[model samples]
Target chain A: MTTPTPSSPSGPSRLDPEPTPRRDFLGLASLWAAASTMLFAAIGMMRLPKAAVLSSPSKKYLVQLPDSLAPGEAFEPPGRAVVLFRDEDGVYAMSKVCTHLGCLIKKNGDGFDCPCHGSRFGIDGSVVKGPAPQPLAWHKVTRVGEAYMVDEGVAVPTGAKEQA
Target chain B: MSDSPIKTSQSALGRFWRNLAGAPRAVWRAAFRSGAPTTDRTRSQFVFNNIFLHIHAVRTHRWSLRWTTTMGLGIAAAAAFLITVVTGILLMFYYKPYPEAAYDSVKDIHFVVPTGRFIRNLHRWAANVMVVTVILHMARAFYTAAYRRPREFNWLIGLGLFAVTLGLSFTGYLLPWDQLAYWAITIGANIAQSPREVTDALGITAYFDPGGFQRQLLLGSDVVGEEALIRFYLLHVMILPLALSTLLAVHIWRVRKDGGLTRPADADRRLGPPPGDVYPVFTDAPMKTYHLAAVVRGRSPAVGKGPENTVPSMPHLFYAELAALMVTVLVCLALAITWHAPLKEIANPDVPENPAKAPWYFLGLQELVSYSAFMGGVGLPAIVLLGLGLIPFLDREQEGTGEWFGGPGGKGLVARSAIFGLAVVLLVETVAIGFGWIREWYPEAPQLLITLLNPGTLIAAAYALYSMWLVHRYDSVRSGAMGLFTCFLCGFIVLTIIGTYFRGPNWTFYWSMADWPKH
Candidate 1:
């Protein structure tokens, strides 16, 4: 530890007792009041970006399965992230969003390929290559009489499918 | 009182005339406290009196005025930034930030608003110029080893300035809301999300995803849309400019505090001391004997220096600064007049541009991303930036502080490093392009392995090995740093050129644009 030289300016000294305790109490109370106000203000400010209502495309969308779609073929609904597939196993929906970064994967032949990163997923939504740790997610598909309701926000088991 | 001097003017008309006659002198005096600087003392006072000009020292080393030393790159960058600010503010008058109106506003600025196109073009050209000049300025500082001793902090600040410069450029790129801007920003946002690669590989993304967090923070959502446009606009117009200006002030202030610029130790002797010593000899007899002077902890910049080699900054330094600013303005104006900043069709999210490229500066990174997204975009850039930040700290030797390439031997080292770097990058890219990566050969390859062993990582590893070899050969840290920096520079240039010119649709390699298959 370094000691100050004789010529050096001295460090802080012991503080004297408060001359006006009541005044000090009042000042402290006001300071706390201001601090709490600011804290609440900051908390309120933080809530602005976490909006209660978000202006975005609805996650749950209804997509009509194309009648012409053959077995094992995928049909991507416009403005939706899920790809509906019709196979002998019945009807299923796989999310086209790449698990790696979120670039919409294109259906390359039977599997899906990410354009940003080369992550391939099998037609069954199984990871066929590395870089993409998880397989393409399977979205919940509920049979709605004529059209199927696909929930893009919900992920189900890989083989879960709705009866055709 | 009225009888004194010639007959005093007692009338109101006479007083008004006298006040009017004295107004010019009063205004001039208020602006410049000192008169014309005929003498050295007045010249010093001239600088000291002006708040704006006082950042510069009264006396500057004649060597600093030499064009070959710094190449005026710093001032050029400052000039370009100034031009950018002026033109940016002008464009802001008619330019809207909303996604709905941003594209049309840019078109109006391009074709409708009088002189708006010119202002926008100038802003664009000057911003690019600023980036280039700032980069070159850093290169100048590095090759000269100016980051030694008292100037290391300033060098770090310079790096911060460079980063802010790039940030400004990236943010500004999205304001037009065109396909180019939208797609480039999309690629940029994706790059920000590259941390997912590692997190996913480790099977930890479900619990913690920093990549996604960063992307959300940057674009305010998953993708570049309305939120992203507004966020980038705020950053471009306000936040980044404030940051840059604050850092720039400190940077220049530190330069003055650290003694104008780094110069040779024997600079005064080399230049043969300005005409003669301006002060009386104080080192003689009684003054030396009576004064009890102790060695100080830090260097005394003026120690043992006669005043002969230093010239007043009044005309010399100001003249040089003015010339640099003028040249920068002229070049920017010439470019603005000749070219129209490109604006492609408005952004269409459904129609993704094939082979979508990031801005040219980041194209090198994009090329690396194609190799391995996480490694190329995030991991390697982090490593490179960390290495750059550590350069001055690692190479602490104070010798060869002012000469280019750390003295004569550095020239050969830099040349060799550049050539080696160019060859290594080309060879690695060529191999990767011709035969493909391990993943291409083995479909079952692990991502962790691929991330650690791609063309980007290979080139970086090669550069590190070359730098190590240089350290061993020269037995000097400076030589190693010089090698590494030179190699990195060359690699970036090569990668950027290839990314811009060679890569085509689906990121396939082609010799020329003509050879690329039509979409």
Candidate 2:
């Protein structure tokens, strides 16, 4: 084996390196700045919200019902839109959108039937059969003195027991 | 049968013209000098006859069949990539990136566009094939120690390419924007984003954060919408493709630079010179080293004659590669034509999907996630990927000279041990992941262990421990590390494959209630 000469300067090893050059530092900073600027611009364009269109002008209120509808009595409005059902407690409004594919469900006997995918929902907005994963969401019903009010914003969860 | 020199020249020119269809003078010169020129070599010569070819052409002993197999796998992957690109472009003509138009465009493709179904099928099948080929390529590389020194950087780049490949697959998954694609990508992106947590009495944040960067760079906003779709589209079609292509070029170039595939005799030949001076004095080494080593080992050196074993690219490997490429393309086309890509109902962002499944490649990890909040959430897969990326630096043994088992050139007990150990670890992990899924589907007796400790969490913990032990053992005892690492790698492969095959519909999460709340 050859012995090392103490006086001689060692050659640069493969592992060791030096600090970044001024030019490289400047170049990297400029590149980063450019990339960030482009990213911010793109994001700004994407987040620019467009004006919402009013599709159904005729239907102002989702559903308008009498002070009370008796039990087992159902109200199917025009356009096969929202269905209003009454029980001893209050009036419940459920949209026709099927849980499976958003197909409008029609009243078949006691429950609603989805024409597109054959999903079935009971009178209480509970799923009965077919491909629907859960019961239909029930809108909140308010007993305004004697009359009832349906709030579309307060959509109730389809409880686990309601699933087919 | 010896002909006069003039007659030979005439015959050569005639054959050249017939083969090349009116060859130019440059082609003639190259053919004469190189014996027979391949398309790649011909193109190389045409471009610039410098050191580039030296950096591009793959060199290996003919009998080191694994290298050829690897190249075959890579070509298969490249073919799949091409298919995906072509089909993706075709789909792009009909697809709209916006949410409102995305589902409608898909409907149009299925109903209105001519051969749209075929295009969709091609894209799907090609994506699947790309995933398979990449995995196979990595496996072959590991087995052959192709990731060893000088090629270490290339190995890291290979890992990057693997990541990009998966990214392309995952991102493209959402473009259809159907129920399956939407929920699948959502779950996948969620898993991709799941925080990396370390377990204690209370959970601690891991050093690295998962999905944080992905959220910023990929999603941009909180959810998958127009922004996500556009970003994924650009990445799938342009950014990833360019990056992968550039990296692939560099990878191949490095493979050539590192003197191609290592031969069994290379170890013995390298033993003659000291480790430091082995490269430059390589040609001066005694030929006896190769002959004697091969004879003693009961194996013949694949390359004939001395160390200067070189083969012409044409009519041999090039033909094989071309044949492979053609076969790949034909198979992809056939699949594309036969099967229609799945497109379920339109994606309604307000609705929740049930049992949301990630892409197939990530199923193994997803399956793990279902078992425990901790293991599937953060621990094992992260460590594995990070470890894989760091493999090149860990295994610093010089490729050509290292022995199998001991010292400089022997295939000793250490390598064998490593292989077997890795195989065991893989087997255990497979059983663990599988059992975890089964337990989830059918609960075992309500016991403390069953309730508190999920199989996924246990398996992940075991895997993590094994990986840590592997690194430690390898460092402490040089001989056994190879065997252990091999075992670790094999375990992952078995787990992934078995997990993929067994999970059935769960692999793609076809259940309608993907995101529905389960009591």
Candidate 3:
């Protein structure tokens, strides 16, 4: 549908096929030849590394009991960003993040409180105060050995009794 | 059947490949619609047919091919994006944006998971490199005046892409959930409260109270929590990247449609008449040529578009792309091998870092915020971005572009602007620090005056006014604008370096980073 205009350099007014030397064809052909050679070389070099470098291991973590933690106390995993409760009932792992704005709540008397604002949650992770839209999340705690593995992806309601 | 001696050897393997490629003819038809193109016509056709090559023009000007012309920064940025996408997806496999698991997942990646740390390093480093390279691309375009005339809208789009690039990086900053990520983002979120500072300073703001708007907009609440995390995570992983990719396609397409990059101003004298056949035909005839004439600022459409000086996109552009990508990947790999991405303790809001800082990109703003939050964080950056966007409209002179600093004293101008800018910024900073000392000594100065009346803002305003006076003195708005831009860039560089390394406990100055105690 489109054509080059005569005023432009690409139109019918500009084609001087007679002026192009035959040797120009050789140069043009050799350009492709050189490109293909480089292409093969690059592919050959990249292939081995591409094949060898990839290995994806699964990300499931198995929690083991450390010497510092015991059965009757609440411990926040220094790295895990979760608060674990180990009492007579069961071992519970709750998300330390305030459900309202996401700031980690500090442990207060019989409850937790947001330091940024003042959203409060009970010891079992239920919302005891306003501004916190919801309760702190309870997670799935599975028993691997003597210790418990807490899966933070799973969420549960407050006061639900679950054993690891 | 047994083959002949020649056919029985490597020719047999060759024949097999030939048969495989040629089989049933339909397989070949289904695959390479433009097959084994060797000639110029067929090469152009091949490029036209291929989806990848469709983004590129069939031919490119010789100047555009020169490494110095672009310094390969844009191409390298694109290559870095490719690396980011690959590595980001891999990182996402182990990453969860949730609060409890996020920090732990980072630790696992660092210590336990196979190649998780490696991929994270690649993603982090490549993302950083991409931001830098994109900025360099903007600078290259600006210095070369590639955003003039027909390319004005493209410049705006490029700015949009720059914003998205920063957004991508900023959102990604919080993914690791370590102390560094937490505090850095906290500082960034805090800086978002800048608009309110001005509003609060004015008594009228007490009733209207738009101060919390920016922070709430960024964080969805008073603080950074789940909503912030999820929002940042989605923006980082999906929305911003998608937007960047879409805009990048359009930006490149416009470059090709607008008749490639603007060559050097005097290039017409060097390039004479181009062969007619080598000129790219548009989808229409006389109308298209007229449009091209309008777009190209017509001398002749093909004046500099000769075949001898140009090359086809098929091999030349592809080769350049491949080379850039290889170099980028190797560099990224080297960086990943050498330096580990920093991950501190998990997020603990109760015990904050002594001098908590924003990420390095925004550290310049943070440095400014220490003097005056609203002006430094919000007003200054807005002015720079808007001013940059308005350059094409503002500087209408036709001849003085496609070269460094836009004049005969280009390099000299750059050096002078740099020195002037640095001296002003440094002097202002030292004085501001000195004022902090004065406040400590007096203990009677109003905090409000200290907050808003710092010498930093005063010096910056004075510098801007002086630059405008230069515009009047030189009778050139373009020259004036260049001076300011160079000044701002130099100031930004100095501020970032200072903020990243010098400040210590209680936000006090340290002579060297090594002198700071390792908490």
iRMSD per prediction, in order: 3.2, 11.7, 13.7
Model 3, runs deviating above 4 Å: A1-164, B1-25, B271-308, B437-452, B517-519
Comparison by DockQ, 1 against 3, better one = 1
Cα lDDT for residue B163, candidate 2? 84
CA error at residue B102 for candidate 2, angstroms = 2.1
lDDT tens digits, residue span B1-519, model 2 = 357544545578677777676567658766445433445345335323535344445323343333343558777887788788888889889898877688899889888899887788888988888888898787666655667666778778888889889878887888888877776655555444544222221233243554444444456554566767777878778888899888877877776666565444454353343334112212445544563333321235534434334333333445666777888888878877777778888886544343344566766665555443234545565566787777667666643322223322125444554565555545555555444333334333222233245554454455455545645654532223344445555555554554455443322321243542345
* Model 2, C-alpha of A8: deviation from truth (Å): 31
> lDDT (CA) for every model shown?
0.82, 0.58, 0.71
DockQ of each: 0.23, 0.05, 0.02
Index of the highest-TM-score prediction: 1
Interface RMSD of candidate number 1: 3.2
- What TM-score between 0 and 1 does chain B of candidate 1 receive? 0.93
**Candidate 3 residue pairs in clash (backbone atoms < 3 Å):** A9-B276, A102-B225, B196-B211
List, residue by residue over B279-304, the lDDT tens digit for candidate 3: 44443233432544423454556554
Model 3: per-residue Cα lDDT over A36-106, one tens digit each: 99999999975532223212222234566565666645787565657887665777788886543345666
lDDT of 1 by residue, A49-140 (tens): 64344446678878888789999777877777778888777899988766654567788787877665456788887766635545788889
Give the range of the ten consecutive residues with the poorest summed lDDT in model 2 chain A: A49-58
Q: Once model 2 is optimally superposed onto the true structure by TM-score, how far is the C-alpha of residue B157 displaced, in angstroms?
A: 0.1
